[model samples]
Target: MSSAEDLQFKILQHPNPTSPEKRVELMANPTFGRVATDHMVMIRYTEGKGWHDAQVMPRGPLSLDPSAAVLHYAQEIFEGLKAFRTKDDGIAIFRPDANARRFRSSAERMAMPQLPESLFVRAVDELVKADRDWVPSGENASLYIRPFMFANDAFLGVKPASEYMFLVIAAPVGAYFSAGAVTVWVSETYTRAAPGGTGAAKCGGNYAASLLAQAEAKHHGCDQVVFLDAVHHRFVEEMGGMNIFFVFEDGSIRTPPLTGTILPGITRESLLTIAKEKGIKAHEEPYTIDQWLEDARSGRLTEVFACGTAAAVSPIGAVRTKDGEVKIGDGTGAGPVTASLKESLIAAQRGQANDHHHWVHRVL
Candidate 1:
């Protein structure tokens, strides 16, 4: 077993890093998660040994055993956040401490060993700082950072693996779902999570399960899929990739509550806070899909949007169901409240506006 004294990070400089000009060209229009940075952060974990051999090494393929427990049992979880080039030419991350807490919660849900909150944050900070240049400088451009943990023990039995690895990788990216308001397909046939499932966890399996539903959305010529609650199949839980928000003509806002069946997204929480500060009434109660359809159809619900790390604040132009489709706010590009909130959020993230919550962490 390794001691806490051995948890120090060993930094290794990449021998053949991408050139600055070429990197800039790549960042000009880099698709999400396709382009990688020069270096990454990795930490090893053994049940009795605790966490040891923390390193900042060159980004490359992982050499995992084919029989690794994560491969068979899917005992893995991940978190997503971004590093932005602030207005003062600095690099910062948004509310990573919140992400750390969520990561711990997910690790617990996945039955994997916990990576300390401090270690997780430090690993992310190290990688982002190492690849600071990858943080693009433009509207809607930033370095998307992903931190993940998985079982590393090469065993096939259905049990928790004693060996594990935590890694943080960065990629320069633009918008995740495209540039404008998106149309979502209501997934009545597929459910994202049950009452006591890992719906709250940011695990790969949850996403893997949603891919088919997402594919179905694409088949319907929709941009994303919105999932209903598992038990009743009534309430709006979240979009396949992000949290759903409903804005009313009365200027009130409501999002689905975190009832262990939906992800407690940091962006969703931030928007709620921002709405309150702006004097907009906001609530986190269960709102059904029928209610959404009725409100939109009756001119009560004025706008709908999805919030997350990748898509930021995206307006939902319309929703497609088995019955038909209805456009929100006359199928506009972006409504006033949506545009205002998105601008304010992005501005705060980029240091253009005040950091009310102190969520931004400066890395470089």
Candidate 2:
């Protein structure tokens, strides 16, 4: 943990905060990433001083030099976590320390200075505390936290920048899948990550590379896109933004093993822990799309789902390709396995079930 003096942040209040009526209207139909809160947390870094000049300021535009490193080289990393308003009207964040650790991992991968875990967590906590009123209390509604670091050095050289900036922004969001369960398109054409790549890192470049495939999925009338192993294109990797799982009728659940190609999802890890506690068989191994189709046809595969911070656990009803489409479950509804897992996971997050894993971190 960083010392309190070292992690000190300058606080600045918003001059023109949103009114209650307007904020309520926005939260009533808040889609993902559409609106932002009044304030943002920021900290700057230099080669000589490391991370410094932390502040919470009004949300506005950034004035950057023409030769800013992030603009030219795309050196940036980010993380996503949410703060929930519990039944008792207290606020808590789900697995924020996990996000802090992953943020450091992404910083290392991007060749940027790592924000101290304590500072990162404190930044989120302070911002959420100051903006607790921005947290929506409706069902499946909460405050979304986005912490990001980017190179800010103004130089034309194609090397790692000597200066960087870390910022945290918040938004009140409704459920990611407000429409319901989604059908994902298996992207046989575009691969999300290679064996030796930034797939494991939560960097902007990896997501930029996935947008084309995601756009194609939308064109094909699908909600999300799933990628295969870049080398063989035979094994399942993950969705564009989520980790995937397959459940067998015998009560065994399988997810793709971490081959240094898949992002180690916090939600996926939590699900594994909960599944084991419930005596469900959970296996992490390489299973190809063909095997999944075959198992589903033979009545062995009972449920297919995707997991991430944004969507939590969404049942994958069908996997579509140019050749054909394979439906994993009986109908458009979540399977028994998916339902149980989703219920337990959501219950733990919402404070409805005992948090034996101690995954929830209280913010306010």
Candidate 3:
């Protein structure tokens, strides 16, 4: 990894840029993870050379060997964030430094070379500058950034790969769901994380393992799946790709604490900070499904929601099980607290409000 002062990224402009009309049409209703920008950022790392050849070039497919370690061993990790177009015709990223830190942690876990925070931020800045027009300013829309690292060594070995590639891609994404709030099902049959496992890391394998349970949730007429601990399947771990939170009627918010078995979500941490600043009671502790059901039935659990970079904050309608179902609140839509928190966070990201926390990083 290069030092902050020595960091430099070479730019290779794409010859064929997407037409303005087509880009506008796509941005009008840009769904999540669908359309992509014209360019991407890539950097390579090897055993002999630490990190080199940082470039921003045209977006395309990668040519990899059949025996690439990422293909066989699933040695890959990814980070998600967004670049929002502010009202002043400028763009800013939400907590990109935090994402960069988490990316380094993920790299350590996956045995991949960790890129310096300055380099990661610079890569994002360069790509966003090159594709600033792709960022959508429409309501609930922004340019999503995906930074990923993977093992690229072709040698067939059981140990970690000696070569790796780090890449960042951008996508113009709109709302995750067309509706106001989405309903999710509790996955009792599938466990997302175990004690002393890789749950804390945002790796591809964790998501790959939850696909089946997510499919089950979809089959059960739900938008997403909520997973539990692998040990007893009692404590709440997280949703398929988001963190879960429970709002109690006693004017307190509770979310499962970081037990080394849940992804330390950026949105989750941001919400906690906002809640504290707003004088909302917040607790980080374990709460079982049964307890949640009981509390909801007794009007103690006021609201349920999930948080992530993709879906800023989404209200969870109900939790269904084989025995019975627990419907939270009136199930009409988002609660007041959830709505307020979401608005504040979005405002900070979009540069619409005072960013007292200094969470937004200007990319251009």
Write the residue-wise lDDT of candidate 3 on 140-221 in tens digits.
Answer: 8899999999999998879989999999999999887666667778888889878777899999999999999999989988
The candidate, 1 or 3, that scores higher on lDDT is 1
Across residues 53-148, which tens digit of lDDT does each residue of candidate 1 receive?
899999999998999999999999999998899777889898899999999999999888777788888999999878888889888898899999
C-alpha lDDT of all candidate models, in order: 0.90, 0.88, 0.89
Runs of candidate 3 with Cα error greater than 4 angstroms are 1-5
**Residue pairs clashing, model 2:** none
Clashes of each: 0, 0, 0
How does residue 317 of candidate 3 score in lDDT? 77
lDDT of 1: 0.90
Query: How well does candidate 3 match the true structure in TM-score terms?
Result: 0.98
RMSD of 1: 1.2
